[model samples]
Target: MSSLKTKEEGKVTQREILGCLKNCLLLLSD
Candidate 1:
């Protein structure tokens, strides 16, 4: 791939996005 990225890095990004999404949902629910 031209972009260049490691699997571990992808996993970490996914986790951060998920955490942000979870926090947003919680705030909306309240």
Candidate 2:
């Protein structure tokens, strides 16, 4: 159960990081 929770958390963090990276790229392109 703990491992599953950790994996979910990691995925959430990764998604957030990807979103931030995409925003940065958009700003740079503009």
Candidate 3:
């Protein structure tokens, strides 16, 4: 059960990182 929760958190962190990277790219392009 704990492992499953950790995996979910990790996925969320990855998504957040991707979102930040995309925003950074957009700003740089502008």
Q: Per-model C-alpha lDDT, please?
A: 0.88, 1.00, 1.00
Please report, as a residue range, the 10-residue window in candidate 2 with the lowest summed lDDT: 1-10
1-30, model 2: which lDDT tens digit per residue?
A: 999999999999999999999999999999
Assess candidate 1 and give its TM-score to the true structure.
0.75
Candidate maximizing TM-score: 3
Clashing pairs in 2: none
Candidate 1 at residue 1, lDDT? 53
Candidate 3 lDDT (Cα, 0 to 1): 1.00
Give stretches of model 1 more than 4 Å off. 1-5
lDDT of 3 by residue, 1-30 (tens): 999999999999999999999999999999
lDDT of 1 by residue, 1-30 (tens): 534557778889999999999999999999
RMSD of 2: 0.6
> Looking at candidate 2, what is the lDDT of residue 30?
100
